[model samples]
Target: MRRLLNDLKIMLLANFWLIPVIALLVGALFYFVAPPPPMHAKMATGAATGGYHAFAERLRDELAKEGFTLELVESRGSLDNLGKLLAGDVGLALVQSGQELTLSERQRGDLFGLGVMYREPVWLFVRTPVTFQRLSDLADLRLAIGSDGSGTQAVIGALLAANRIEEGAYPENWQRIGGSRAANALIAGELDAAFFLGPAENALIQRLAAEPELRLESLNRTRAYLARLPYLSAMEVGEGMLNMPMDTPAKDIVTLGPVATLVANEDFHSSLTPLILEAARKVLENGSLLDPPDSYPAAPPRSLQTLDEAEYYYNKGLPILQRYLPFRIASLADRYIILAIPLLVLLFPLFKAIGPLYQWRIRARIYRWYKHLREIDLQLYKGEWPDDLDAEIERLEQLESEMGRIEVPLSYSNELYQLHVHLRYMIERLRTAQKRRQA
Candidate 1:
C-alpha cells in the first residue's frame, strides 16, 4: 500500500496538467448531463379587467400549485400578446380566435398554439333601437375602436374592411377604451356603440345586458359573416342569460365569433407541455367557465392549437395518463440511461486492460525470485560459500512474505497461492544449499 501511494504521488507531481484536465472534463459532463433549471414562464395577459388577464391569473394559480412560476405581463390585448410572443418577450400568451395577424417566417417560427380555452362572443351594443342588418350600418356612426392593439380592434377592423366599410367613410367619433372601461363608457352614453369580446358570464358583459337603456344588437348577419370567415362561428346567448335589475330576462341573443387560445413558443420545453395541457384540461374540459355541459368540440377542430398530444388524446376521449405515460416516463428515464452508457463504456475497457496488466505484474514479481534462485544454484555448483549467501536467504524470505499478502479474485487466488508456494520452495532450496556448504 505504501509503495502504491508513493507511485501515485510521483505520477501526480510529474503530470500536474492531468488534474485540471480531469476536473474540466468532469464539470463539462456534469453541466450537460444535469437537468435544466426550472422555467420561469412569462405570459402576455390583456388589460387588468379583461378576460385574458382573468384567465391568465387562473392559469398562473394552477401552474403555481404544480411548482411552476408564471409571470403575467399585462398588454393591450391579443394583438399585443402576439407581438410580444413573436418578439421573444414572453413564452406564452392569450390570443383571440379571429384576429387578422400576418406573421413573417421569423415571427411564425417563435409561436404555436397550445389549445383553445373558450369562445369569446362579439357583443356589439348599440344605444338606439335601429334595424341593424349588417356590420356596414355602423360605418358612419360613432364607434369604439377598442384600445390600440387589442383583440376587439383586430376583429372589428377586419370585419369592417371585409364588408367594404372604408375608414374614410366612418364617423370621426372613435374611442380607445378596453375591458371593463369599454363597458363603462357605453353605459354612460359616452359612446354610441361598443364591441366587447369576452365570455357570456363576464361581469362587464352582464352589467351591460342588465342596463334597461342599452340594447344588445344581434349582428343578425352572423351566419353570413361566419360563411365569409371560416374562423368565426355563430354562438347563441340563450334567454335569461343575464338577469336584469327589474327581474327582466335577456332573451335569445344571437352573437358571432371564436374562442381565445393559449399560445406558446414552438420551441417550448417538452416537460412544460404536459403542465400546459393539464391546466387547459382543468379550465376548458372540466367546465370551469362555460354553463352548458359538454358544448365543446365533439370532435377536435382541425385548427390552430389542435396539434398537441394532449389535445389529440382529448379529442380521442382517452385519459391523460394513457396517452402521455410513455412520453413522461421516457423523459424521466433519459437521465439515468444517459449516465449508464458512459459508465459502461469506461468500465468495459478498464476491466479488459487492467486484468491482464495486473496478472503480468504478479507473475513478474514471482519470476524475480526464480532469477535469484538460479544465480544461487550456480554459486552452489561452484563449491564456494558466497559472502552474500545469508543475505540472499533473507531476501528470498522477504519476497515470499510479500507474496503471502497479495489478494486477488477467488478465481485468481489459486494462481497467487501457487506463486507463494513456489517462492517458499525456492527459499528452502537456497537454505538447503547453504546448510550443505556449512556441513
Candidate 2:
C-alpha cells in the first residue's frame, strides 16, 4: 500500500499538467458543442402588418411561460426569414412551404425542419371578363409577383418560370407592394391581377371579395400543379368564408399554395423538444384563423423542422404517464430514468472492482521484495557459497529495514510481517557462511 502511494505521488509530480489539460479540453467541448438549456431564442418574423409578425408575438408569449424568452426580429417575408436563419442571425423563423429550396453547401448545414404551422392560400384576384381558366392563360397579362425577395415572389416566380413565362414575356407591370396596398392596386385598375397569401381573416381579402368589378381566379389546374409539385395543395375558400360586417363572397373560390412552417437549427436541444411541443400544441392542435376544427397535421405537409420525440407525442394524443405511477414519482422518473441503465452498466462494475484491485496491486509490490529474500535464503540452504556473502547480508538488512516502515492494510499485515521474518533468516545464513569461510 505504501509503495503504491509513493509511486502515485511520484507520477503526479512528474506529469502534473496532464490533469489540467484534460479538464480544459472537457470544459471547452461542453461550452461550445453542448446544447444549452431553454434559453432566449432570437426569431425572425415577417413585416409588422404581416401574419408572420403576429404569429411570432403569440409564440413569444407562449414560450415565455416556460422560462424562455423569444426575441422577434421583423423581416420582409419568408425569403428574408430564411436568409436570416441561414446566416445564423436568428435561431428560429417562419418559411413558406412549396418554394424551391436553393441553399449553398455551407448554408445547408444550418437548416432543419420543426413542423408546419399554417397554410398560406394563394389568393389570386384578377379583373372580371378575362375568363382565366388555367395558369398559362395569364402569361401575357400584367401580374404582380409580389415584393422582391418575399415568399409570394419566390413561389410565383418559380411557377411562372416553370411554364416558360420569362421576364419580358408578360405585360411588364410588377408592383413592389404587400397586404392591403397590393389588394387595393388590383381593385383600382393599377394592376390587372394581384396575389395575396395570408390568414383568412385578412381585411384586404374581405374588401376585394366585396368589389363587384374584381373576381377571384380559380386555378382548376390543381391536379397539374400537384403532379409537378407535391407540396402544393388545393384549398377551398367557400362562399361567405370572410365577412365584411356580414358582406361575404358570392361563390366558392379554390386556391393552391403551401403552408408556412416553424423551423429551427438541427442542433436544437432534445430537452427543449417537450417545451416546443407544448407550445405548438397550444397554438396548432385547435383550429386557428385558417384551419377548421382538427384539420391539423395537415395533409401533404411541408416543414423546415424535422419531427422529433415531442412532436411524435403531440401527434399520438399526449397520453398521461401519471396513471401508471404517483404524480410526483412519475415526473421524477421521466426526467431521470433514461440515465439509469447506462449508469448501472458502466459505472456499477467499475465501482465494485476498484477497492479490491487497488489492494491487490499494493500487495503484489510487497510480495515481490519478499520473493528476492526467499531466493537468497534457499541458496544458503543448498550450501552454495560466494565470496560476497557479507555484502549479500548487508543488502538483505537494508531491504528489511525499508520494508518495516511501509504502511499496509490490516488484511495484508501478516504477509508483510512474514517478509520481515524471511529477510532476517537470510541475513543469519549469510553471516554463518562468512564465518565458516573465514575458518
Candidate 3:
C-alpha cells in the first residue's frame, strides 16, 4: 500500500504540467460559447380585462416557475399589440390572425409567428324581440361595430366589405363604441346589437352570455365568409357549450372568426422560442369550449413567417435538455452541446500525449545518474587514478544503496535493474584498478 501511494505521488508530480493546459482549454470553452438567453422579456397585451391580457397573465405565471420574468405591456387591442412589436417596444405580442392584412409589405418583414394560442370567436349579440335574418337586415337599427383601432373593428370591417357594405356607405345608426360600453348600450336598449371578439371562456364573453335580455346570434353565412376571408375559421359552438347551467347559446351556433396568435419580432431571442411555446402549451392543456385538449399553441393561420425554432418545437416537443433541467441550466447545457464536438476534438490529442510525456519524465530521473558513472570510467581509461581509492570505492557503494530506494512502476522495472547492473560494473572496475596499483 505504501509503495502504491509513493507511485501515485510520483505520477502526480510528473503530470503537473497538465494543470495549466487544462485550465486554458476550459477558459476558451467559456469565451467561445454564447451567453445564456435573457432571463426576462417584455410582452404586449390588450386591455386589462381583455382575453389577450388574460392569456398574457397566465403565461407570465408559467414562465416564472422557471425563474424567467415576463413583463406585460398594456395596449388597446391586437392592432395596438402589433404596433408595439413593429415599433420594437416589446419583444413579443399576442395578435389576432387577420390583423396582419393591415400591415404594409415592409412592416410584415419585421415580424414572425410563434404559434396560435386560442380561438377568438366573433360574437354578435343583439337585443331580444328584434331578430335579424341576415347582417343586412339590421342595417337600419342602432349598431356598435367596435372601437377604433381594435381587432373587433378590423374583423367587422372585413365582414361588411365581403357583404359589399363599404365604410362610406355605412348607416348613421352604426356606432364605433365597443367592450363594456357596447354591452351596456345593448342592455340599456340604446343599441340594437354589438360585435365582440374573444374566446368563449373570456370573462366579458361569459358575462354577456348570461345576460337575459341579450341574444347571441350565429353567423349563418359562415361558409361564404370563410371562403372570402381565408384567415377566418369556422367554429362550431354546441348548445350549452359556454355555460352548462345557463345554456348560453340556447342551441347550436356556427361562427367565423380569427385566432389569437403569439407573434415575435426580430429582436426576440430565437433560443427562447421553445421555452415560451412550451409554457403556452401548458397554459392551454385543458382546452376551452371551442378548443379541444392540447389543440392550441398550434402552427398555422399566421400572417408573417414562422420562426425556425418555433417550427422545430411544433414538429418535435421541447429540446431534450429543456425537458428535464431548469430552463436557465438547460439553455446553458444546450449552448455547451453545440460547441462540444470541437472541444472534444481539441482535447483528444492533448489526452493522448499524456502517456508518452509521463514515460519521458519518469525515465529522466534514472538517466541523470549516468553522468557521474561516465566521468569515473573516463579517468580509469586515461590511466589516471585517485589517491584515496578505497574512499572513492566507499562513495560509489553508498550511491548504489541510495538508488535502490528510488522507485518506478513495475513496467519500467527492467530499466531500473539495468541501471543497477551498470553501477555495479563501475564499482568492480574501480576496485580492480586500486588492487593493480597496490601490486
Best by lDDT: 3
Local lDDT at 224 for model 2: 71
lDDT of 1: 0.68
TM-scores for every candidate against the unseen true structure: 0.74, 0.64, 0.86
Off by over 4 Å in 3: 243-247, 371-407, 410-413, 424-439
Model 2 lDDT at residue 359: 64
Tell me the tens digit of each residue's lDDT in model 1 across 222-312.
Answer: 7677777777778776565556452323467777776787777754564565566666566555553333544432222344443455455
lDDT of 2 by residue, 157-199 (tens): 6667667777556554566566767776778887777787777
Pitting candidate 2 against candidate 3, the one with the higher TM-score is 3
Q: Runs in model 1 with CA error above 4 Å?
A: 1-29, 37-39, 98-100, 174-178, 244-250, 266-270, 288-391, 407-413, 428-439
Q: Indicate which candidate wins on TM-score.
A: 3
Lowest lDDT sum, 10 consecutive residues, model 2, at 296-305
TM-score of 3: 0.86
RMSD to the true structure for each prediction, in A, is: 6.6, 7.6, 3.4
Determine the C-alpha RMSD for candidate 3 after optimal superposition of all C-alphas: 3.4
Q: CA lDDT, every prediction?
A: 0.68, 0.68, 0.89
Question: Ten residues in a row with the worst lDDT in model 3?
Answer: 300-309
